[model samples]
Target: MQIKDRINAFINLGKFLSEIDTESNPILNKAEAENGWFTQDNINFALNSWAKALSEENIKQWLSNYNLETTAQRSKIVAIIMAGNVPLVGFHDFLSVLITGNKALVKLSSNDKTLLPYLANHLISIEPKFKNLIEFTEGRLQNFDAVIATGSNNTARYFDYYFGKYPNIIRKNRNSVAVLTGNETEDELTKLANDIFRYFGLGCRNVSKIYIPENYNFEAFFKAMFSWKEIINNNKYINNYDYNKAVYLMDSFPLLDNEFMLLKEDNGFSSPISVVFYEKYTSLESLKKNLKESELHIQCIVSKAGIPNEVPFGKAQNPELWDYADGVDTVDFLLKLP
Candidate 1:
């Protein structure tokens, strides 16, 4: 199939997603029933984000960054081991493989078993050629030329041992962080709440940590976070909030609580659900050095502190097509495959 054929198939798929009534959609209902974390609002937000991204204009602009051959090339079967922490977490990798004219051997995450395959079947309907290019296997993946796997730091070691010989992109646990200068307006802080509470802080793109200036008061920050107070209504989220709070109290760990979320001072990046770890920074120069040394553990930075490559407030989860994860160019990896 031609590149245009693949692009057109995605564009059509985007239209289908955009037109659906997610509030009353049966598929979405089933997904939510299967995984309590996959709430209807969150799933709708994901679908909307993807629909906006797959526009012809957006696709063309993203492709402009690379030299793509128009005609079909020899296709490689790229095995994708997906992570299901959030809805459609593996869709980007799936898109990269197929859009680059490679066959995808996808292994779905048990937490997100239904959504992608349903969409894959739709893509096949849009461009029947995709029927041969897309696949899902419950058994061991075999005869694939390359691999792209996403998991925790532990699973990454296993992936390395098994797929080390192939050309691959294996991603491990990484968390996002925010740097606060304490000069941010209430509006900016409100937007920052979206980065914190979206998807109930499960996705890697969620801001699990923050660096604040010494003696900074959090009155305004907590006020802004009030916008997402309804998040506590979700049973799973509230359970985590209550449990983490009880454990911290029992252990004599000091914490700041606002009835919905907790903030604790720590030097860690991967915070637990309903808790955001924080560290007080003395200077931007020293903080920059620390972040540089720990770049491998960071997925993205959200700040207005003049940090290079920092994502703007509230936009961490709304990544564009070219915002490659872990700063790796997946399309480039697939294109150079032998």
Candidate 2:
């Protein structure tokens, strides 16, 4: 099939995802609340967009180095080690392998075992060709020529030490941050909320901390995000807030609270729970220099100005098809493999 047709297939799958829900599914509801289910809404938004942009025409246009000079083409396998932190985190890896005509040997995350298989099943209904390419495994993951793995900073150390010996893309722990100029209006703050609540602030792409000018008032930000009070109202999410808040309060740490979680400012790389820590910046040039120094460590930067033209706040979540996590293009890399 053409790349455009493949994109349409993805869009069609998104529509299917938006409608299929088990009304009597206790398992489904529980997963949605805590584990970030592949909900119809989430699925539609994610899959539909991915599909439309990843059409063959677009893929071929971008994949200019595509040469049909490889041996045993269109039948290789790629093993995928998925992250369980959010719904369908591994789907991108799966898509890269499948679109390149390689079978996917998937090692599903225990935290998200059902969603991938269900999604694969849905894709099978959409195109039976995927049936030959997708399958679930507990431990039997041999026979793949390449692998894609994502894990914590600690686990990434292990993954690199091991998977480095093979044809693999091993991702370490990377966190995103926001840059505030102390001049943002309320609308910008509302849009900034997307950087936080997209996946309950689960993925590394989520904004863990932000940079604001000294003594910057946060009431406006809090007020802007008032509609998201439901994030704390969620039992699963609230439990995290309460547990973390209690630990902090017990340690004699002051908390600025409304109804959900505490807002704590600290000198760290990232924040925990529902709170987002901030730092004060005096100049844009300093922020840019710090970002350049920490480029490999910083995953995404949410900023209005005083940064590179390529990076934009709230635009991190709507990444195009070619934009891989940690900014590595898996398709480009795999296509270059000898």
Candidate 3:
């Protein structure tokens, strides 16, 4: 298929996603049945986000940055090992491989097995040529020119051991964080709540940690987090919260609790569900340097502190089409494949 044909097919798929009625969507029910974490609201959020991103204008503009006309001649097959932490997490890789006029051999995450294939079928119905461009495997992956895999740091080691000889983009675990100046507006804090509670904090883009000015008061932060108090009603989240809280209490660790989420002073980036880690910062300059040193471990930064490439508070989940994960350009990687 030509580049134009591929783009047009995705544009139509976006329109289909935009028109889905969550209240009446059967696929969503089946997804939730397979994975309890795939709640209706979160699944629709992922669908709608992709819908907005796949617009003709957005896709065209994003593609303008690259030369894709030459990509068709290579016709490579890319192996994609998707992560199932959040709904449709691997859709970006799937879209990249196909839109660049390359074939995709996909291995669906067991946690997110149903959604992408269903969408792939929709794409095929829109453009039958896509039937030749996409394949899903339940067994060993073979006959692939390159690989794109996402997993935890441990699994990433396994991917490296196996796929190291090929051209690849093997991603390891990374977390997002926020730098708070302690002067954020109520609206900004409310928006930050979405970044925190959305998908129950499973996404890499979620703010798992925050840097607060020393002596920062917790009153406003707690009040702002109240907006997501309803998240406590989720059984899995509450169970985690209860268990983690008990463990912390047994260890006599200091904790700030608001009955819904726990806040602990920690230097770590990855926080458990229903908990957000926080650290006190004395100097912005020093903190920026520290963050710069740890860039590889961070997916994105949410801040108004003027750090380079910082994502504004509450906008972490709404990544643009160009926000490549792990600071690696997937399109450029594909286009350069020999």
Candidate 4:
């Protein structure tokens, strides 16, 4: 299929996604049945984000930013090993391989087995040409010329050892962080809460940790976070909160609790569900040095602190098409595939 046709197919798929209502949509019901983690709210959020990203104007603007005219027109089969952390987490990589005039051999994660295939069927129904361009595998992946895999640090090593022979983009564990100046408005902090609570903090783009000025008061932060107090109503989340809090208390670790989530002073980037890690920074310059030293572990930064390339507060989940994971350009990697 031609590039324009592929783009149009995705745009139509986005329109279809926008119309899905979990209460009434059979597709969504099937997906939820297949994976209990794929809650209705989370599935709808993923669809809305994808719809916005796949709009005609957005797609054109994103493609315009790249020079695809010189890309070699040969076709290659690109294997995609998707992560099931969040709904449709691997769709972007799937779209990239197909949009760049390559075939996709996708291996779906067991935790997320239903949604993407349903969308793929929709794409083929929109334009039958897609039938030849997309395929899913349940067994060993073979006959693929290149690969794109997403997993934890341990699984990434296996991908490196096996797929290292092929052109590949293998992503390991990474988490997002926010730098707070302790002067943000309640509105901004409210938005930051969305970044944290959305998807139940499973996405890499979720703000798992925050950096605040030393001696920062917790009153305003706790008040702003109260907007999401309803999250405790979720049984799964409450279980995590209860378990993690008990573990911290047993160890006599200092914690800030609001009955819904726990906050602890930790220097790490990845935080457990229903918990957020925080660190105190003395100066912006020193924080910059620390961030630079651990850039690889960070997926994105949410801040209004004038930090370079920092994603604005509350917009971490709404990544643009160019916001490649692990700072690796998937499109450029596909374009250069030999």
Clashing pairs in 3: none
lDDT (10s digit) by residue, model 2, range 1-338: 44444445555665665555555445455556555434534544454555555555655664555542341255677778888876667888887776666678999888877666877787888877667778778986787788789888888887787677678898877878888877888888887887776666777878878888777888888887775776765666788888888888899887778767566777576677677776777877887888788777778888887576345766766666666788888887667555
Q: In angstroms, how far off is 55's CA in candidate 1? A: 1.0
Best-to-worst lDDT order? 1, 3, 4, 2
Q: Using Cα atoms with residue i matched to residue i, what is each candidate's TM-score against the true structure?
A: 0.99, 0.86, 0.99, 0.97
Model 3: lDDT equals 0.94
Q: How close is each model in CA RMSD to the real structure?
A: 0.9, 3.3, 0.7, 1.2
lDDT of 2 at 274: 78
Clashes of each: 0, 3, 0, 0
Give lDDT: candidate 4, residue 178: 91
After superposing candidate 2 on the true structure, give the runs of residues whose Cα lies further than 4 Å from its correct spot: 1-8, 18-30, 33-74, 309-311
What's the true lDDT of residue 192 in model 1? Answer: 94
Give a tens-digit lDDT track for model 3, residues 1-338: 78898999999999999998888778888999999899998999999999999999999998998988877788999999999999999999999999999999999999999999999999999999889889999999999999999999999999999999999999998999999998899999988898889999999999999999989988988899999999888899999999999999999999999998999998889999988999998999999999999998899999998988999988899999999999899999999998
TM-score of 4: 0.97
Better of 1 and 4 by TM-score: 1
Residue-wise C-alpha lDDT for candidate 1, range 98-155, written one tens digit per residue? 9999999999999999899989998999999999999899999999999999999999
